[model samples]
Target: MYKLCHQQQVDNACGFYAGHHMLVIAGSKNIRKPEDIVLSTGPLDDWALAGLRESLAKFIMSEVISSKGEFHHPTATY
Candidate 1:
């Protein structure tokens, strides 16, 4: 069975990766916002970027909830 600790560890790793991705996008000239990164304006398309945004949003929200112990979506489905 997967323990909460294991889940947390995974979440932490995901949070780190998501943050890194955001940082890289911010540093890059073409990608300023998270939405921009998803938009890609090059080889990639908007649908894929939308998915990335959703995943990153989940990871970021999870990190914030774990660390701050406040602020939550009362009826968040995701």
Candidate 2:
């Protein structure tokens, strides 16, 4: 089992490779309106980016509950 650590031993084991890593973001887009925004994945894997899109899906496109607690159908546009 792999337990996530809080870098307790990081300071003690600081090595040359520690400063060699770099973070990169693939691509980004600015939406004209927050509500008109739709996120799509590129040919890459990023945990942070993927999780962010999934979390925001509900807010971007969601159905409202009526008096009967039934979901409303969202009309699609061409």
Best by TM-score: 1
My TM-score estimates for the predictions, one after another, are 0.30, 0.22
**lDDT of candidate 2 over 1-78, digit per residue (tens):** 333222323442233112211121122245354444333222223464455556445534454333232355445331
Candidate 2 residue pairs in backbone clash: none
The C-alpha local distance difference test score for the whole of candidate 2 amounts to 0.34
Segments in model 2 whose C-alpha atoms lie over 4 Å from true places: 1-45, 63-78
lDDT of 1 by residue, 23-58 (tens): 555677764454444322233234644666686687
Error of 1 at 20 (Å): 10
- Candidate 1 TM-score over all chains jointly: 0.30
